[model samples]
Target: MGVNTLYFGVDFGTTNSSVAVYDGHRAWALPLDPENDLPTSLPSLLYISRENEKIVGRAAADAFIARNVDREVKTKQVDLGVSVEAYVGAEPEKSEVFNPALVDPEVRHAVRARATIEVNAPGRLFQSLKSLLRQPAFKSTEVFGTPYQLEELVSYILSPIKKAVDGCAGHAVETVVFGRPVRFSDCDDENRIAEDRLRTAAKLAGFKNVAFFLEPVGACVEYAVSVEEKQCLMVVDIGGGTCDVCIMEFQGGSGPEQRLAESRILSVAGTPVAGDALDREIIRNRIFPLLGSKARYGPSNLPMPQYIYNQILDWQNIYKFNNEEMINWLLAAEAFSNCPEGLRALRCLIQKNYGYLVAREVEAAKKRLSEVESTHITVQRDDIQIDDILVREEFSHIIEYTLGEMRECILEAEQNAGIRPSDINLVLTTGGTCLVPAIRAMLEERYGAGKLRSRDSFTSVATGLAVVARYV
Candidate 1:
């Protein structure tokens, strides 16, 4: 019997991630866990608990909440008459305190505390993710993880995929294709080092063969397969971490020949500012204000609720920590410090799962408003009511901030190709965020509505990579 060749297409995104495999003829999107019909695509979240050295995924999401103190709980108990105290002295209150002498110590303490809690979280998270891969749905010869750098944490996530694929395929699978952004924020040396680490991790995960592909180029290959006619096309793959654009000449026949011409990458452009940032902004600006500040304890000034909210947001964006857990942690921190209003509100927020729920609603609303005229987001707890149906305008502002960079990339691509906008046949868009109307409109206006076309916004890149893996 001959060995069957299998190609795995991975879309390792910042917000959400997915993997698909092509077994010669057709491609199948693998489930993240056995419980769902769809391929396992969830937010790229990894939760670590310093206390237990445990990492968890969707399962940890609830644990985060349970561990997180409800902000609302602390707020409602305002009448309890607990001392409303600030950690730092009150002399510097009512003004922006940027003094390193005063700020450094507090910031150091918070950072150390957070770092300590997160230390063992990644490993535990990998373990939980590994458990997910062991499900019976994705049977393959061997499973592999695709990471930019082969850290144990990355291997943790990848091993499950390898296992699932290996079990499903019913053979000893080896060669795996991993995707990388066209550009990396790290230097060339660092990037190479990262790739080496990733390769090592895959080997440790038990994979025998591993290859790399530029994410956007991989997406182009996926798009080229189904393309019947050859034309000059620009592929824009806007993912969670970076925005990658590729200009390729697709020569079509039985199979398309993709000649990569010019590519542009924006390192700073990402969904961190788009999806997660909006969630945190709402929490800090809207939800936390309702909780009030700590002012009565020991006359020391304390970090503002908004400041803490930003920290929480940053944490969620970077580590994929459980939101409920994060909120509860915040609440517990406040309670331990005896901040009356904050502790009370924190308790309520935890009890009602307000922070996590509101974050989800905000994300949903943003996604909805992107496609439609308006959308409503309802964040309900017993006493807290946050029902703000966002219209296109509000969503537009949020999108515009990100689109500014996209527009620049478009111009750069045009310049690099040395062709005017009219010479381009189509501006093909991919990535989850390309679903936004504002982004679509901006591209249409710039490249001419006739020249603009959006491929499968969600799966185009992954699909493209599948084809690339088969041929490349």
Candidate 2:
């Protein structure tokens, strides 16, 4: 009997990650947990507490809020070696720098504290998720965390889908067609390094063979699968992390019978300043003010335990928050003082009371801004109140700074491919962030609206990846 062929596609996003599988004719997203019908897309976060030697996910995100730690931290911050600080609401009257070694002690204490807390309990959190991923519905033995190598996180995110497919097929799946951005980081060497890292991660994650498809190109393939006839179409993919554009010539009939005449990834643009960056900017620019004196300490002058900053950095991931818990923690900020010593105490208090709320406001704003023209983001305290509606303009301004580079990238790609903008046949868009209006407008202005095309803004790459897996 011929072995059943099952293909899995993974979109390991920066903010959220997901997996999908294709069984010859149809593509379906795989559930990470049984409760949700949608494919599994978890925040790319993992909380590790040495005291209990424990790790947690969505629930630990909640614990982060109750403790009043900042939750706007990004994976790139670790890459940049930026250190974050935490502020407390008490006073020591003198600046005292605690030893870095104290991080272990502080984390241990925090973990122990969480274990006792009912809502923020790590054990329960861990068990809940463990049960969810291991449910018979997915037929998976393990759910992995973000990979240790920053580059490998994407591949690790993809592994579960591969596992599910292999299990369903009852055989090892050897090859995959993956997605790539047309342009990555400014530094070609860095961008190349990132790609190499991803390739390595895929191999380590259990794929024996792999091929890369530009994200926009993949969207065209999926779109072409449904449409017919000769036409020049453009595909735009706005995703969580990157925005991509491709133009292609589509020919032939509907169903599985279609032909791609010519294709080029016009621009693969990303703002290191994506949704996560915007969230952090909101925390740093808006939400932090609500912490009053405790949040005022400058990174340079503040004298406090290094662990406090470590905690703040840890709390920055929005995936760490648990609803109003983050807001409540910030409400306690009135008790904090502005002096370095006072800030240390306030930081400690926040770490104990409201870390996760700060994380959530930032996260919510990011999600809101994507679909809505404006969003009201606020953090309330007796003495400190932050209430502001972040409008589309503000987001557009931030986005433009990055999109400018993308435009330049398109010019370069055009130059490299030796094709004029007019010569482009179709434009393809993909990625989650591509849904942002400002981004779409910018592409339309440059490439013309008639040339552009897009798949479901979020899942096209994974869908194309499934197609690639089938061919491999």
Candidate 1 lDDT, 135-247, residue by residue in tens? 23322221122222225555555656677667766876687777665554324554555456556667776677878777767666666566666667777776544567777
lDDT of each: 0.53, 0.50
Tens digits of lDDT, candidate 2, 255-280: 44335333323333332324444454
Give the Å error, residue 372, model 2.
3.9
Clashes of 2: 56
TM-score for all models, in order of appearance: 0.68, 0.63
Error of 2 at 468 (Å): 2.0
